[model samples]
Target chain A: MKFLKLSMSATAFAAAMAASTSAMAEEYKMVILQSLTGGAAFIGKNVADGAAMAADELNANGFFGEGNSLVYEVADDATDRTQTLSLITRLAADEDVLIVMGPTSGSVALAGANVANEREFPVITTTNSMEVIENGPWSFILTQPADVTIPYIADFTAQTLGAKNCAIIGVKDNEAYVALQRKYEDLIQAQGVNLASVDGVALADSDFSALATKIATSEQDCVFIGTPAAQGANLVIQLRQAGLDPSIPILGHNAFASPTFIEKGGAAVENVYLMGAWVPGGYDDFSSAFSTNFEAKTGIPADEWHAVGYSGMQVIANAIKDAVAAGAVTREGVRDALGTQTDIPVVMGEGTYSYDEHRVPHFGMKVLQVKDGAFAVVGE
Target chain B: MLSQQILNGLVTGSVYALFSLGFTLIFGVQKLLNFAHGATFMAGAFIAYYCTISGLPFLLAIGFSMVATGVIAILVDLIAFRSLRKRGNAEFPALVSSIGVDLILVSIAQQVSKTQVLNFPFGTFPVKFYTFMGLRISLLQLVILATVAVLVALLIFYLKKTTFGRQVRAVATNERAAALLGVNAQSVYLQTFFIAGALAGLAGVLIGLLFNSMQFLMGEPYMLRAFVVVVIGGLGSVPGAIVASLMLGVMQSLTVAYLPSGLTDAIIFALLFVVLLIRPNGLFGDANAVAGGTRQ
Candidate 1:
């Protein structure tokens, strides 16, 4: 009886130890790179904050798994391509890191894509460069490519807004802006709109007085601003001040999503139309939840950058959780899981967001108009 | 349209001339390239922006920003160039040092702005327009032209008539000789820096308003354009900088209007290259553009 009782006690203690082991949770960390400084810092900083907000909520609610939590660290790239390259390599080399995300710019992300492939590390980012997709499979992008979105916006401007001729102006040195403008021109011409003159300025150019005069007198029905938010805003303001008829519409792209455009352009941007990757008013349940939670944490209403960042984080966490569920926690396992993710719920895309065989994520967008210092859905 | 474009160019060029004049002024006296001059320009805009948001009147904010930037320019000299100047070999080292200081200032600005572009509150300046001879011009443009003219005239008059001007010219001719002749060389340097910085600051405010946007790196392109203006104007010639700035502005405007798109910088830089090849000393520059400031 004594031996039997002793055996039973040992068995109970063994079972208790096993139960405790199962209850223990492990922490995983992902590294994010953003241009928290330099020219692109406005977007980079917001995206990083959005990702951080998502990670916080996931950790609090234990969304990853029964015993797993997600945490993140953000490193500033300062919008330099070479620095981004170095940061990606360094972050990937860290054995404790689960994944890497972001640089917040498509033009700058071209450098990081090569590193991701070489390191065989998964770099999920909101960088929307199609050329980056060709670089390697390691880079999983969340934002719609400029080629896809710009053309769509151009069609809307030419067709819906009824612009007969649209003049273009932007910094010539920026390949991204140049590419975007070229795409817009192509689409508008395809839609039977006349192509007006394209005005190009060097980067960091302040005064648009001369360009404004040319555009105002050119008789274009509309003008497509192929520049960043700040530059575009200043240009439009100058154009209006230089006697461009306020009746003529102004067209823009993702840069208009930035609050800077409206804030800086003020009365000038009224009635301007632009495409957004995410329309907050479009009403996605997931987006709404993320916005509410993010506002609660950061005290600022989440915008496009925030939505992209949050969506990217959710995708990463879901991939990791899938890898964990399959009992394969390796980097490759996480990457493969991302590849096979089906019908994943996201905040930014329209109508059944999913990845194609080429590893490019496809989503829909909206065209918005500036009304009374706020963005209103164009058709709605 | 052609006349309108010319007017537009002149208006834009006036600001360029205002900005370039300060840059040339520094080279005129100290004979050292203060790349940090751009930082002072950026700072002027920022200071004015903050002052405006703090509820200071527009004109008052402009004055405060001017004073603050002048002081900031002096501080830049103290930190970046003075030590090198004291050591008696200030040229290359000063250039490198000024570039370093420019980076630090830009970095600090980036942090302060959180990388967001700033705009003055609407109605910071009255927006009124005028049309004459089929050329439409805003009241702001008229003000900019008048401001540039008045400031340039005042600068020229001050340099030509003042005792301080004589000292500065004496130092420009020969720092050691000026020091031997009882001209306080250091004081002259500080004064020139202040003047240059004040002009740059004023230019910054005008630009911040004209463009309706301000960013940490806003001064960079102006610096490049101003460098071209300074080089083409003859490195240390104030008059040269003004004429070249206006000419470049008109040419740039014309090119954008008539030429193929995206050819403005190429045309400008090509002109710069041609000028360098043809007149090495520049259109108005003297042979001794460096002056005899290279001393120990």
Candidate 2:
């Protein structure tokens, strides 16, 4: 009889402890949607790492407050647009999910924006295209638009570099690069810069010999490369090998300001200029702190993609913090708070986060140059 | 500009000929297409790349890669084609089996390299240019042309002047008759596959050096072009493959130089379609592949 009484009391105590623990913690979910496999795996993996680090930091620091916890549900879209749409819809419908993080590629992000708008859920994307945000009110873009960055680059080429004849080579298969190339073509031609030649190559093509030969013979003062970092590096190296003047100005998109470019291009990338969103150590304290943490964790210096992803997580984390402060941590609450996020701390650059009516972040890129196999701010 | 483009085309065509010669030689002997030829090509470059990066001399690396890829090709035959041949399966089965092996090889490569585009360290080859008649050529290009020429001559000498070459030709003419005459058919297959793979491996290494990039998927595009080269040259005609390779290379170069960049592929394939329409047997293919003139 004494043993039975003890067991009953212990069961009662266990039940009470469970109830208290449950009441003490409130769970909010942040759904991370991005490509974890397929061709975009490199970018997607970095983005997911950044998001995971952000979540870990927030939970560890009690950023969500004493009685609150943030949970992450990661979904791999596999870099497919249809999969992105379906996953975004499913995440939006989940009652515990407060916000969605990304479908990092431009095409997938654009499709995801449609689902977010329909479900009235908030999404922050790391794609370079502004069209993703323009798709809906619930969308926020982390990277600066190509329209803003590309034109600035063209002007810089004309005004600062004093380039007369500019040659352009774009990867034709990529829609983002094509759009960027078209914009550059128009802007440079309009700026009275003589267009030497406009050429395009397939995405996986490594033999830029044919194109490099053309560019080398054209006598262009500068060459604009609108390909991905890997391909761009190949072009730059092959161009130099094909007997193009090493001192000739070579310019590239934001993607070129990456360790991959430097590592792959080796000595070829020295003096190559890039227009990108982040300049390492040039931004605020948060930028330095983020860089230190990222290098400590990843063992490599952060690139532009890492910056976009890290800043993307900061935007969502800040929104969640604001929602918890306001006593409303629902999806609607997070969405509204994110919409009103003016002066929210981010790691991309110095400016505080402010969103326009379309929720597109008004940010600009600074010019960066690769010197001694590292990215440094131009004119530094 | 045109002269320079043509020179560039010749350099590219030589590499294509080196790759296609192996593919055609295999098809000529067995009347089967080895889709895994491309994967074998890729493996050669990858092996050579690892060897070079691991501090081996470039020449030794090339030799090692060729031998390794040759062994791999023999294994491909043993695994993919041998069982089907024993079962008396049609040609299509061999094609399907080779594709499966190709996927397996490519997957292995992707895993090994982690899908990164690797480059030979700078100074693996010097960057020197020679200009003549207002057209520039690199020392690397000259070396490539010489390598291809020497390799082709060696292959021809091995096929035409050796006892094993006679056995291979006899087997190609009739497997049953060759077997009856005491020719070891299996050995012939092994020898042919080895030779073909070695040539492809060498071509892959050279192309990798030329482009300064090597990846698992790098073989895929070249494989597609190999099909065109072999088909246009007549499936199994070595001399025809060499000639057609040069022509296709010149055509591709001229198109890329003059036409809209997007239309380059379309135009090349269209040229292939026209060739097929005009010569269904390919330029040098046997009109009647069957010996003994169809059953009476």
Candidate 3:
């Protein structure tokens, strides 16, 4: 009887230990490489916040299998391409990290894409360059490429705004701006708009007096600004002050979508039309929830990058959930699942994500205009 | 179009002249290359920006910026150049030191601004334009030109007519000898730095208002252009700086308006290189090494 009782106790203890082991959750690791401490830090901070918000929401929703959790690690790339590659390599070598997101800029994203392919790890970048996916199968981009978006901007400026002649002002010596200027040249010509002249302004030029005077006197129907936000704002302000008709339409690139432009440009940027990647007001239920929760948690207004970051992470989460459901949750499995993910719900645009054969997300954007000191949807 | 461009160039050139004058002035007095002069200029803009944001009147903001930048310039000398000057090892060491100080100032500005571009509030300056002889100019341009003219005249009068100006000239010739002659070299250095800083600050505020963009890095490009202007104008020669500044401004405007965009920088710098090669003493420069060392 004594031996039997002792055996019974040992069996109970063994069963209890097995039950405890089953109750503990398995954690999947994700690593993010973003530009957090350099020139792009402002955008980088938003990206980081959005990703964290998605991760938290996913974990809370139990989207992963029962007793499974997602964990993340973040590192700053300082907006440097070489640094991005190094960080990606380090993250890829880690067996624990299931997937990676970012290296925010296009130039840096190009390098990151190659690293993802070489290491057989998946990288989802928010870079606006379509060329990012050319690095191969494992590389993905979440934002609209400039080529796709610029045409729309040009078409709208020509058709909707009825601008006949347009002067192009761009920052010289920037590879991106130079490319943008050429794209504008092509698109404006296609729309039968007379390209008055292309003016290349130096970066950090405090006096735009000459350029402004030239543009104002050109008698163009519109001025298209192909510079970053700050420079664009100053250029427009100086242009207006130089006696350009206040009613002349000012067409802008994606960079002007930032509220900073409206704030800095003040009364001058009043009729500025911007083609932007994200439309916050177009949020679906899923996006609305993410947006609400994000603001509640971070106390910062969500911008284009916030939406992209959250969407990128949501796609990652869905892939992980599918991988977990298949009982094959390796990095390769998550990547394969991402490859097969179609029409996954997102928070930006129409709130659905579909990937091309190249694994680049279908990036739908919106036309935004600043009216009454705030951003409002154009052609609503 | 050419006339308008020329008019624009003159407006922009006046500011360049104002900036380079201070730069040459310091070199005239001490023969020291104060790299931090750009930072001093930047600080003026920053101060003026804050003052405006804090509800100070527009002209008051300008005054505050000028005074603060002037003081900052004196501090730069006390910290970066003074010890080296005392050791008589100021040339290269002072250059390196001023650069170091410049970096520090830039870093501080970056932190203060959070690496964001700032703009003056609307109505910081009234915007009105005038058309004359088929050419257009803004009220701000007119004001800038008038202000520069007045400042230049005042500077000329002070330098040519005053006892302190004579003392400064004496010290510029030979500091040790000037001190022996009871010129009080210390006061001369302080006054020259103060004036230089104040002028730079005024230029900073003007440029900031003109562009409607105030940023920590704005002074960098002006500093670079100042080099070209002072080199062309004959370093240390105030009148030479003015002429060279106007020339460079016009050249830049014409280049941008007519030449291939990529060639502007190459052309400008090539001009600088040619000037250095052909006339190392510069067009208006003295045979003496020190800027403004010769009256002619």
Off by over 4 Å in 2: A1-42, A45-126, A134-142, A280-301, A320-344, A351-354, B30-33, B88-100, B170-177, B287-296
How well is each residue in B62-122 modelled by candidate 2, as lDDT tens digits? 9999999999999988999988887775489999999999988987887677556778888
Candidates, ranked, DockQ: 1, 2, 3
Error of 1 at B176 (Å): 1.0
The model with the greatest lDDT is 1
| Candidate 2 C-alpha error for residue B248, in Å | 2.7
Q: Write the per-residue lDDT of candidate 1 for residues A212-329, one digit (tens) a residue.
A: 8888877888888877777788888888877898888888887667666777788888888888766553366777687677667765566678777777777788888898889888
A1-380 in candidate 3: lDDT tens per residue?
99999999999999998888667878989977777655565556578778888888788877775767889888888778889988999888888888887877657778888888898888887676667777777887766565766787888888898888888888674444566677877887888999888878766675776778767777788899987677788888878876889888998876776656877798889978987766543346766676577667765456667777888888888888898888888988888898888888887665677776766667566778888887787877
Q: In order of the candidates, what TM-score does chain B achieve? A: 0.96, 0.95, 0.97
Which lDDT tens digits does candidate 2 get at residues A6-59? 999999999999889889887788888877654565566667777787787878
lDDT of each: 0.81, 0.80, 0.80
Clashing pairs counted in every model: 1, 0, 3
RMSD of each: 4.7, 4.3, 5.6
Of the two candidates 1 and 2, the one with more favorable DockQ, higher being better, is: 1
Give the C-alpha miss distance for residue B235 in model 3, angstroms. Answer: 2.5
